[model samples]
Target: MIDTAIPHKPNPTFEGLKRNKVWLASITILILLAILSPAQARFSLAFTLDALLHTAPFLILSIAIAAWAGATGADSLIARVFTGSPLLMIGLAALAGGLSPFCSCGVIPLIAALLSMGVPLSAVMAFWLASPIMDPSMFVLTTGVLGTEFAIAKTLAAIGLGVMGGLVIYLLARGGALADPLRAGIGNGGCGASNLRTPQPVVWKFWTAPERRAKFGREAVKTTLFLAKWLVLAFLLESLMLTFVPAEVIANTLGGTGIGPIALATVVGVPAYLNGYAALPLIGGMLEQGMAPGAGLAFLVAGGVTSLPAAIAVWALVRPKVFTLYIALSLSGAFLCGLLFQTWMGS
Candidate 1:
């Protein structure tokens, strides 16, 4: 007898595991290491766990801050800086981008909204350049993984890069080089646009309301999980790199105290970059292997701005000319920042 019963679908748990690329990659690496080199697998696991434990305090603080901001709607304040004079807006936007918690992809919707609302391209460019480099959570994590001084330098670099980009776009915009920056058929960011256009009042004491409490819980869980997976993967990679990659090799390639190494690092950064959080431990490993501080900085800055995801989003959203300008600014700004940082370190 032909039954009309529907076929059972694949297990949800299996499907979820399949979709978690980072975790899958991590597990695969560990399994391969175990099979090929049990000693290295043991060492890598221990290293990853130890690093995670050491970073616990900073991780908790970062998670709380991110979740609190989300629950309280503090992100709305970001829109306020877009008003005022173009120069002032540019400055403020750059500063805000350094401080704001938006990632590269996360900033795209906001960019679309600002561009659609007649906000000057200079200020938008400023925010766009800086938004991916540093944020409160990222700064905290950076301080934990890299040193406080390095984190501070990175934060400053983010703002400086933003300002540089803003100024360049401003001058070119004045010369009529960049008009109608958005690509055709792009809507005003849909859901995210309205939030910027009419921001809701922030509720500082979000715990008072049931919905806000729920939101806080959700945000906290989400942020914690996100950071955990990336950091675990990062520390694991660091362990492998430290064990396998020779110091002399790193030293000879990216270790020299000169602009040449920094430039090479800037170029390498665009493609070699993994994820921003994931890159920290890898950079730490590189530093230990004699990679220069300036090269590290260049890699971080360039990777943050021109990572595949970030660059793709920019290309998809803007006209070709604007996209070209963004790439030019990112590479130049990264090189300049690295050079300045190297000089400062030498001094």
Candidate 2:
């Protein structure tokens, strides 16, 4: 109030930023030096293989499903309906989540891209809440790694949590707290053709018409290409994590201590961002080595919800407050799900 006309001077030098860069570079150099030893590299490679094995099945399935959703307009239909009704959206999201391989990190980029292109918040949230636990990759890997009992328990737990999470979000933002950020950005510019209002095409009546069939086929091709463009990078990044990270380290860090595993999994995953496909084999190995099923679930849920890229993409549309709330909501749901698994299914 006293100095309204005075200009504030910002420091011109990026010294703080420079220091951070130097520190990060030093750490990377040290890690590389350690890996230079053949023995250590071999050990690292073994863990990498386990991670890759865990990730493979889920990635393949999720990509396939995403392609299907994109081509058939299922994603757009689901988004439109779910955005209007959070409860139904959540249930659908939870159910779909159970069968996908995107994990938290992998899901984030793809989901964020979908949201950017007009997917509903509820469906996106559902994917966040459920995908890690529900995938075939996780089911198969955990069954082999931790036993059939654990696998069955995990699948049930994921569905339960996915439904509950979606419900909670719906209740919290019932009157539109969860507006579509991408749609908001569109204003009147017609950003997302997918999100635009168009005359309903006559479906059954047009089924036999060659012109309609051709149009539908063209739309399918376009949608598939759009989704694949966003997903390819996620797949490649997941592969890199699988190739380099140590499964033993993850297992040990996330293994036990009751809820500590859940909390640590949520926190640790903020950066590591494991793909469900890549995460499965590694988690299986960990369970084989005595890691708790609850911990594995936490890793899966938290890792999917806290992806860095997803956060960045979402921030573009929603305010920081909404994005932070989204993260908190997603993580809390994941944590609760992990605990639920422990409470009901633990050995």
Candidate 3:
């Protein structure tokens, strides 16, 4: 049985959010100003609202999943899944990450929990780096938009890159090259419930408890606000690019194949790729405009790894060194995947 007699602790994440509310509010106000700007008057309020509404379900699902995972005996289950072998754990964790329904952001709570429970950071890195690249729904959407080959390649890349990341971290940990893989300070951040003082005694039957619901509600509010703040900024930037940037220019810049375009695709993909779901049609449009299939793959993989919201959630969870290593491995794997897929497409 889990302990119910727990004391209140300062939720660093929530407190940090509260402190940063001013910045968030400032960004919101700026977005409104941009919308109301006479030069930008034609900018659609509907577009901004649609983006927000579109992401609502994902955000909600992230929070609920976090809450449920927190309340369950998932820690033991997660640990049990990995035997003593580091390689096996890395392979399985990466595979689990790709197969799991959770997104990069939604799994934050669970990752935090796992790390807190002494789960190998290397194993978690494998899962973390891979989980966002593709999921079942994302897979179906990619196949429909990009074709079966691309989708399958992406799924494979997610797993492969995850393993690579896990192994790199594993070696790093073994050599004592890095310290504190799980960055200290941020507690229970992301879609996961904050201030999880205890695992709530009921474990599996969590829905029956008032405390669980309350915890869920608290996390929901914070996650929504945190995501919304970054999203508004991202959307506003996207809108400006759509309005002012020319498709022809983009096509010319990223439309080619080979190493140059592939490298650009990987680098630009970090900012270019929006949330995974919305990126499909946008990518399809780019492909129609002569964007190389390999470049597109690079963009998708890199973007998923480096997207603002997901990246922020990760930065909050881990130290700067680990985060930097993650970005390097992700982009490296993304480029390699793009190279392989590019050759396949040309063939």
The best candidate by lDDT is 1
Residues 1-347 of candidate 1 have per-residue lDDT tens digits of: 99999999999977886999988889999999999999999999999999999999999999999899889988888998998988999999999999997755458988998898899999999999999999999999899989998999999999999999999999988998888999997757866675687889989999999999999999999999899888998999999998998889999999978999999999999999998889998999898889999999999999999999999999999999999999999999999999998889989
Q: After aligning candidate 3 to the native by TM-score, how far in Å is the CA of 107 from where it should be?
A: 1.4
By lDDT, highest first, what's the ranking? Answer: 1, 3, 2
Those runs of model 3 whose alpha carbons end farther than 4 Å from true positions after fitting are 1-80, 186-248
Q: What's the lDDT of the predicted structure labeled candidate 3?
A: 0.72
Clashing pairs in 1: none
- TM-score per prediction, in order, is 0.97, 0.56, 0.64
- The candidate that achieves the highest TM-score relative to the unseen native structure: 1
Q: Against the correct fold, how does model 3 do in TM-score?
A: 0.64
Candidate 3, residue 173: the lDDT equals 89
RMSD of 3: 9.7
